[model samples]
Target: MKKRFRILVTGSAGFIGHHLMLALQRAGHHTVGLDALNNYYDPKLKFRRLQEQGFNTEEIKYDTLLSNSTLHGSYFIQLDLADAPALQQLFKAQAFDIVINLAAQAGVRHSIDHPEQYVASNLVGFANILECCRRNRIKHLLFASSSSVYGLNQDIPFSTSHRTDEPISFYAATKKANEVMAHSYAHLYSLPITGLRFFTVYGPWGRPDMAYYIFSKAIVEGKPIRIFNYGDMLRDFTYVDDVVEGVMQLLDVKPATGKAPYKLYNIGNNQPEQLMEAVAILERLLQRKAKLDLHPIQPGDVRATFADVEDLALETGFKPQTSLREGLSKFIDWFKMYHKINEVHALQEG
Candidate 1:
């Protein structure tokens, strides 16, 4: 099979997007990256990632063809999925073989304060993507769904067959909606769609809003970290490399159809570790202790998350091998170098 083909990857400037694009490029695939470059967190960081990947930083604009260059014959266009006509035009121009949709308003807590963002990005934006794929007759579509869909299931290891109607947050609800929407398109139009329910993904170039990044930043700066749920939360923290690898494996593997080509799977570490356990690991990695301020769990927060990866293993040979300790160590090392933190004393005295 010729794995090297034109692939359209949304959220290409994001943490996972950046890593996934690099992986595809390394595997000799021609990729096209599209991102809104919104100031959701920091556009500078996004641009930096693009620059690191050999994209010309100076040419990039909010919504323009910043560059036509890449290390692996890749292309980039500054586009938003919400713009229906613009997205349609891009699909018309590129004729993408496969699409991996990773762009969405991401944080769970943020969704509580700003539910509209979720509706716009996760709902409407996703609809646009589906429309484009159908019109272009794309071979396959893969999207990023969250483990948050498990909501209050209280299941030990979340399975694909589990009932996911009880979503605790607006964010989780929107993700579940995306799954339903994708399944509908697959059944209606014969579009092969696969949705991956990702667990707590943390590593280098991660989102600033994520717990590991925020907590680590606070801990390093001697600020009191918000230890929510009295530090009783647990998560299946999966590493970035494992995530990209699993996604790469699915490039050639389209959703199989007995009746319709629609499938969903959970991609995560089978092990769930406590919030405090993760903090402790971070502390050990940074050589500094956290000034913990334990508090009650916030709204839209879950007590635990675990993933059942049997389906993923059976389909793609996906296995998460990085331990929390090892992942945390690599993250801390990158964090220090990225921020130019000289010493533990400097980190503490800051």
Candidate 2:
């Protein structure tokens, strides 16, 4: 018999968070999703995601629990992690068996402009979560790290054992701080923690800021698409489904006792696809020719990213199975339907 656990997933309304929340609900787990739903890109999309989970966006109040109508086992709360008092109260009330902290101020370039946001959310918010888990006695703590943590490394495939001391971007630095912070909590409180360094994750319900999503929209609207580094970038684009699968697999599997029970792994597709090749695939799928706008590599942008998933596979016996072409096809289908590209030539014209 499978054990049905009470899970707390932070950032539940975000791209990966929404998918993960639905997946957990479907699997018969009592899950609670928490998100501030800040206007990083579009709050409407975040609200839409919450709405799909049976939350009425208009009625949602901060720090209040919103129950899912369709799935009795799911709930959502709109709150920031930095609110220590509220978070502590909720943690004490729920007594969650596991926590997956996916909430963070994402985007490297955005961090450059708004370093304060990263400090507030990624640092202070994360600290609050760690303290909550310690007081609540969470069985296992899993959080999202990033491939950006491997900043400036020329290594083909990034590994967990690699030295991530020198982070090029503020976003990456904050993530690295998360790993160390979790490790300290694990060491002191004897908490079981796992940090997953995710590569370029994309698929249906993807973030609009991502290159693939932007490129798709531009191509559909017959607008020029900017190719950074003159289309010389490489990325290990892991599909969202695959990332969820990896998370689900590692959910109940706690790190071995002793040594603070701290573990880290890279969750990504072992396959790295070239940027131009991916654009070509998008063009083919969308049936449109993209006007090429070549540009130099932007600050805080890495030339390439690949993942060494052998450690993850060895521990969990799981590897990402979705091919890039197949994943893009699914994304394109969703994009067209969701954005209503047929109704208008440009959804959000720049």
Candidate 3:
């Protein structure tokens, strides 16, 4: 029988976190969601996702209560991870069984511009979370790591065992730092921890900063989309639903003996798609061609990423099965519906 206890999901307003909360609620697990809900992206999109899950923004502080949904013990809280005292207070108030740390400063390019935000959210904020977990004696801690940690390695399929000493971006470096930090805590405090290295994650209610979403926006607005690296970059674009499924499967199962209760896995489609190829699929789905301005690759960027999911399969029997075409179609359909862009436009001139 699965153990049922109060679960805390930081970054509940995020694309993955929101979906995970819904999945947890459907499975009858009590959950608490905490997110800063900052204007990093469009806050309206986050609010809409929360609304679908039966959370009213005005009421809850550290957590929001579910009113009409099947979730009997689910709540959402607008909180920042940097607030150590607030996090400590929450841990004191609730007896949480698991803590999924998804709240962090995301984006490779943004990290270059604002290093302080990354330090505050990913480093200091994570330190605060670890302290709270140690104090509360939380059972399991699952935190979000990124595939960008793979850096500039020429390895065809990136594996967890690969040397991750090289990180190109501050964002990737921070994620790497998180793994080291987590390992230290797990080793010292005997805390069970799992770090997930996610590839290019995309789907419904996804962040606008992502390539897929940004390209779609540019295509719709008839604006020229910048094809970085002259359309040479490659990414293992995993669908959001598949990511959520893998996370849900791993929720109860923590690290075990000989594994430090601290494990890492590459959560990705395992099929790397070329930059140009993804754009082609998007154009096909939207029935509109993107205005392209091919440019050289920017700094803090890698040429390709492919996840070796052998370890993930061994751990949770988790396999990413979504194809780019199917996933992109779903996202485009939702985007059109959400933005009320009902009619499809003719393909633009090259």
Best-fitting candidate, measured by lDDT?
2
Alpha-carbon shift of residue 220 in model 2 (angstroms) = 1.5
What lDDT does each candidate get? Answer: 0.87, 0.89, 0.86
Point out the higher-scoring one by lDDT: 2 or 3.
2
Displacement of the residue 262 alpha carbon in candidate 2, Å:
0.4
Candidate 3 lDDT at 227 equals 88
List pairs with backbone clashes in candidate 2: none
Per-model TM-score, in order, reads 0.94, 0.95, 0.94
CA deviation > 4 Å runs, candidate 3? 61-72, 344-350
Q: What's the TM for model 2? A: 0.95
> If both were scored by TM-score, which would come out higher, candidate 1 or candidate 2?
2
- Model 3 worst lDDT run, 10 consecutive residues: 62-71
Q: Which of the numbered candidates is closest to the native, going by highest TM-score?
A: 2
For residues 1-350, what per-residue lDDT tens digits would candidate 1 score against the true structure?
A: 55577889999999999999888888888888888888889787788788867788567543333222233477677888899988887777666788999999888988989999888888999999999999999999999999999998976889989999999999999999999999999999999999999999989888888899988988888899998899988899999999988898888888878667999988898899988989988888877789999999999998989999999899888999899999888888878877778854454211
Q: Which stretches of candidate 2 lie over 4 Å from their true place?
A: 61-72, 343-350
